[model samples]
Target chain A: MTAAQPATGHDHVVVAADVNGVSVTEPVPTRWTLAQFLRDRLGLTGTKVSCELQVCGACSVLVDGAPVSACTYLAADIDGRRVQTVEGLAARDQLHPLQRSFVEHFALQCGFCTPGFLMMAKALLDRNPDPTEDEVKEYLDGNICRCTGYEPIVAAVLDAAKRMRGQA
Target chain B: MVLPPFALHRPTTTAQALSLLAEDSVPYSGGTELLLAMRMGLIRPTALVDLKRIPEMQEIRTDRSRLLIGAGVSHDRLATDPLVEQHARLLAAAEREVGNARVRAQGSIGGNICFGEPRSDVATVLIALEAELGLANSAGERSVPAEEFFLGPYWTARDATELLTAISIPLPCAEGVYLKFQTVERPTVAVAAVRRPGGDYRVVVGAVGEVPVWADYPGVGEVDPVDLVGRTSPVSDLTGSERYKRHVTEVYIRRAAELLAESER
Candidate 1:
């Protein structure tokens, strides 16, 4: 409820980390989350953050290729680790397979949950390139999409997996 | 959103980590539990000590008869670790069942144990297997039985300066089986059963009590897990009434007992 603290260039020691293939070493506040560090400090606003309350799965990101809720993960924890956000998933202008599939299958109505879903699916497919429909559902058990019903999102993830595995 | 500003220290060695701990220095393991508490104003640490960089504290080794799980091992690693799969499959399964995928990836088994949550699935499984906890401090290292580790909700026997180093489980003589029922973030009730080749069994119930209840069954025929539920007074909070939790606890005990019997066959 108090005023938000100044995010970047704080009076703290720089912790080096790799964010989307970019090695960044900056003085981050000790209390900042990976989501806040990316969106507020690094100017990578593609990583959506929905504050600390609610397990809505809106602030999900990839830390070392693992799907983690960025609302809770400390930025200090990601020091010296690789973080792949929705921004990193795409190479330049070419969309990642999951991003493309989301658009094709109408996975998002408002697109707020798109970034989180894409990053989580990317992590899931990275570990399991060929996940079953049930496996995809299970892998995304934590991720919630209220805008577009789960079936379309699940279908999009399955389609993305197929494309990533070279089957489509 | 703003959190109270604090200094961060990354200690690569156990001795350095121990030296940094004080009344105000909070040692950060996985940050899954601590960060949430900090956000809620439950705890305010002046210094946050990061301990994951220590190599010795991150080793998961197994001997011929027992497996040692480093405190820093993530729940994801525990779910798929070869030694945990072969020696403590019940633990691996419990770890896999603890939370959703993202929580498992970020939370550490040590943080889970040290947090001492009343409805902890990991605590119940560990107590049932009779795992030993390794604690380290500036003084020295000592092993404590899991059954005695948990004192209450969010309370453990660990000293402020001591850090949980590892958890060790012996090879089960029979089978280690655990069953849980949950409709919320925390389980409704969790029961674990360990059997021996000689027919003796160890049963521990979690989430429905102050700590994991290590039960002593009076032989195989005299005491049934279902009947034992009505006899104890378990605290009832958000999950349900005391009576309802007791009912669910009985169900899991019966199912875990059934799995233990099937393991023998």
Candidate 2:
């Protein structure tokens, strides 16, 4: 344990966290959002940012396995926490089950919203590996997809759930 | 849009937190509402005293005849906590539907109350349950009923120097149904009709007005939807016309009462 430092009006604070299984520590602006920290600072551009307001799940990311709106979350607050983004889904040379399911089910059209959808769905599956269609819809209601009519997205999640459970 | 720069402080104790609070240095818990306000330029604070690290602020316990919920507890926790579910089932039901999964995981009950959002499900249910807010400042601590804590939209009874510490609901709290007419993120009209322990009935209508409007009845038959509708001040907005909101307010009030009656059987 270190001695308590005097509180200062410094705009930047050192943030230490495990991002996508990699430990990252850097001085971040007090106002820097988790989205900015992931995209601009760490180059984890897989997380998208739109509708900075939390209404749209375009900026959804997992903080300690719970979904959060990264655009509005302070990067400084991620200290000593774990963050999982879309980039964290794959294990080099292989698409994650969710990503593979999305491709097979054609869950994405424009693909702009795919990362967000994938991440949010992953968060849900992480908690409830087997989800009914209605449960998946309820969980993903906060996320928006302007393509594929959301049916395939729902199907993809169900399929991914089966794959993860060794029933596919 | 980036939030305006502000100094941040993390305090572990209530006394330390109270000493750090000032007019410009505000309590930041969840950032679900405060950070959004900052981005919209609706509020600008020089410093943010982050309260998430406080141990006492995250506890949920029963004290005598009251169920004490820590101010920093998230909506998700409230929805699932055994004590809250057992003692205040209506609150748990309402908590389950607050915002979405992310908001539920991130937003704090204290932040929800302190923000004083008129369309808040938690506030309407708490008011119906007759929950009391525990507040603290450098001078001392105080308690305010949920019904009186919200003065108006984005306005609360809490002083700038005070921080909400816990929400205390009387044990054997009122049990009922919370129904809302929501087509958007926020509810258009939310109604909570509950039968308290003493055989009295309460119906609180919120979101369709500047603040939640409630009434008490001696019996389920005595609950009047028309009278409750007359009390609300629903304004015409994107959700619905004032007349439309009034119509739904009456409808939801009646439906809530009906459901509450059915639950008793």
Best by the lDDT measure: 2
lDDT of 2 by residue, B1-265 (tens): 7789899888878888899889999999889999999999999999999898789999999999999999999999999999999999999999989999989989999999999999999999999999999998888899999989999999999999999999999988998899999988889999999999998999999998989999999998889999999999998998889999899899999999998888888
lDDT of 1 at A139: 74
DockQ leader? 2
What lDDT score goes with residue A127 in model 2?
81
* True contacts recovered per prediction: 0.51, 0.66
Q: lDDT tens digits, residues B1-265, model 1?
A: 5667888777778888888888788778777788888888899988887777788777888877778888988899999988778878888888887777888888889999998888888998888787899998899999999989999889998988999988988765336687888877678888888765455778888888877776655343343876667655678788789988887888778887777767666
How do the residues A61-108 of candidate 2 rate in per-residue lDDT, one tens digit apiece? Answer: 999888999998999888878999998899997999999999999898
Candidate 1 clashing pairs? Answer: none
Quality of model 2 by C-alpha lDDT: 0.91
Error of model 1, residue B178, in angstroms? 1.6
For candidate 1, what is the DockQ?
Answer: 0.40
Chain A TM-scores, candidates in order = 0.88, 0.93
Model 1 spans with C-alpha error above 4 angstroms? A1-11, A51-54, B172-174, B197-199, B218-223, B231-233
